[model samples]
Target: MTRVLNFLRRPFVLDLRALALLRIATAAVVLTDLAIRSTDLEAHYANMGILPLHVLYERNWNAYQVSLHNISGLWQIQALLFLVAAGFATMLLLGYKTRLATVVSWLLLVSLQNRNPIIGQGGDDLLRMLLFWGIFLPWGRMYSTDAGRTEPKPAAYSYFSAATVAYVVQLALVYWCTALLKNAPEWTTEGTAIYYALSLDQVLMPGGRILYQFPEVMRFLTFATYYTELLLPFVLFIPVGVPFWRMLFVVVMYGFHLGISLTLFVGLFFLINMASVLGLLPTPVMDWIDRQVRTRTQRLQPHLTRLSNWRSPVRVNVESSLNLPPKTIQILHGLRNAVVTLLLAYVCWWNLDSIANPSLTMSEPLRWFGYLFRTDQHWGMFAPAVFKDDGWYILDATTPKGRHIDLNRKGRPLTLAKPASVVSLFKNDRWRKYSENYLFVSNAYLRPYYCNYLLRVWNEDSDNAPVRRLDVIYMKEVSLPNYKVATPSREVLCSCETAPPAK
Candidate 1:
């Protein structure tokens, strides 16, 4: 029992520099995500957009799920919430009130994700989970404003805590679950998953097209991806080889994500995943970094001293008045530990249940708990099988003046040749996800909503010709082992007449 406790506590005995790096990386990701979402503020968050609050609630909401975005029907309120989230992200980056900032950022992210679940992918879930775990960490112990205010100097390493165990396990489960869920033969014997993925024009970037020409290389990568995810996570448990294995995992996984980013436009998925791996960087690396920083500071101290001598130093004193008794502090600490343990245990149970049965339904109370906290997780990325049908969308619109125009290009007919790259059509990951959702037959409702929204956007533009009618069309290419001459299928999803502009 003692050995088990010691083993579990090992991950929590982390270098402060590692935690500081994690803080910076996570904050950067949050800022980048908010900036991207801001570009399509009204289109994604408002009632006038593709997914209004009512529609979102009707389709995805349960008794327990809560969203600040759902509280208001107005776009301004949602925008304000987004701004506040950005502010929290900034605070987190600066390491000022880090725990509070982390909690607020996570809450806002959950609100935004629940507001329109359609626009989110695996990356959003990872980001939320990271922030959730971050709240319990001593991330502000070093390289932070809080650290500067302490009377006695803070330690260079953080004390062991249960939250550290949870963090490491959470990351391990991500890879393990993804690998287990990839039950398709292509991931094992056939090794054609990357081949099909690269062939999909919608998710593919320019580099993917160039890589698609080399079938053998794609096959090698497909096998590598599978084995890497399957085997690397288990390395976390090898106590004797922890450092070497962790360093290997970090390098290989970082490269894996880099390759994915180069070949596909997965929004912040790669970036967030990469950032999360920074937490696993071995202590030696962190120590080396600290040493280098110290050396640099020593080298610059003389110059800094001369510059400081030019101005009179101002001294300020700060004091803490509120103090809790030892007994009360012990009780509070126990309560916090109990709460964290329970949450971690529940999350573990959910992960196991999901792995055993992807379709398993939890009890109502458990389900409600997950919904309330937005802790529901699913890491199946291209599992079972990678999507073989890749396509682009073509919006055919009829003007109020009885003229037909392709909304993909202004003043162009619907018969124009498909663009070489469809990536330019989307502003960010949210738009990309929205387009991907439309490819599925079950998400048919998205067609009419998006068509109406597009028409409204066009009609609202006084500088452009007004559109009265719209059709949502999908042009798809089927992927096969060998390149063959095939005709693209054009399928019309839904048609709708534009509603008149609001007075």
Candidate 2:
């Protein structure tokens, strides 16, 4: 027990400048989201369909107008929230009043999430949540607006560390639940999970039929994806053998996300998964990043060398004399070595299911698989499926309602007439690689939003058809350069092969 306490109290050290840089980078990314959304505020307001504050108030029989949606009155309040979030984000970047700033930053984030649940989308919310927690930690001890405020503030520091741990735990729980659910026989045996996904609208497709046609390749992909997820636990614990395995797993997972973006019209979901995985990037990768950054700074130093030297000799001497040795840095000294050690262990064990099964369902040990199969949701989104007396079957709805209805039966020509909005946004040259690459393989690769979209498209089509045979052929191609989001050609030709061979 004494040893454990000593370990928790162990001091850890890190470069203050690096933490500051990371803070700025993360803050800039968050700010960019605000900028993008703010520009489209009017359009978003009309389209987002948020639950109005007044509506809630009226429903609850409140007297005063509690609405936050009015253009005249609420606009300023909304702007203030954005400003506060932006201000705290800047303070976080500058390392100023980190403890207070972290709490305020999170409040701003929550306000935004609540304001327009749909428009302000992406894993940025989750990242902000985690960063908010980090803000309370000893993060500001180094590269912060408070970089010089290194005096011991035990209460503040304790709060920050606790927040950070809470964020970590939230991330672990998310991955664990997702991995636990993805295991299933259908995903393993036929690769049906991805096959149904491939026929979605063009935005979600990487390159149309070209990707899905390679049957053998798809099969291998199916196996590899599930297997890697299942083994996450084992790999996380093998300290001696872990480094290589973890690296490989990270690469594979990233590649899978990249594929989803390319093929599907999905990108945000990929970022969310990537954010959680950031916790797994071992210290070495971070060290390498730091080294590269330092080298670049060194290269630029020559330009400012003369100016630096022009400083008074006394100023230089005083600063040099006051510099603290690495061992003497109190923050590093105070880090409980046990906390770091236990944190790593918890990370490995908590999300073990992610390593064991990457999908949102379970497959092996048939006994437990049934429980997973019974669940309908996967990480806040449902799968693209239909109800049957036996079980649920997945379907594609991006094809025309007329033709998609026919394809439900097995072994049909799997062709579709030009869809009105089948083409993917990612497939366009404007976003190009940044868009389609993630959308294409998103479902198989674990891109959350895209997967949700897939599920929605499927479930929406449930009332439409019974299967026979469906083949769609387009009479004319669709082309319209002026429109940002162009739809596919509507001229569809469909036929049923499962019907009796016409005498």
Most lDDT-accurate candidate: 1
Runs with alpha carbons beyond 4 Å of true place in candidate 2: 1-25, 45-51, 55-73, 118-125, 142-145, 148-170, 183-185, 202-210, 237-249, 299-503
Predicted structure 2, TM vs. truth: 0.53
lDDT of 2 at 388: 12
Evaluated with TM-score, which candidate comes out highest?
1
lDDT (Cα) of model 1? 0.79
| C-alpha positional error of residue 492 in candidate 2 after TM-score superposition, expressed in Å | 19
Q: Write the per-residue lDDT of candidate 2 for residues 81-102, one digit (tens) a residue.
A: 5676788778765656766766
Residue-by-residue lDDT tens digits, candidate 1, 1-503: 99987775664466566777788899999999988888788888888889877787777667787788888767888889989999999988877777789999999988888888888899888899989988887766655555544545443354456677778788888888888888899888899999888877778887788898998999999999998898888877676666787788789889999999999989899999999988777778977876776666776766544222111111111112236666776677677777888888888777777776756646666677877897778888998789887677788898877878888776576673677777877777788888888778778777777888888788788887878898878787677777652577888888999657799
Error of 2 at 450 (Å): 22
Q: Per-candidate TM vs. native?
A: 0.90, 0.53
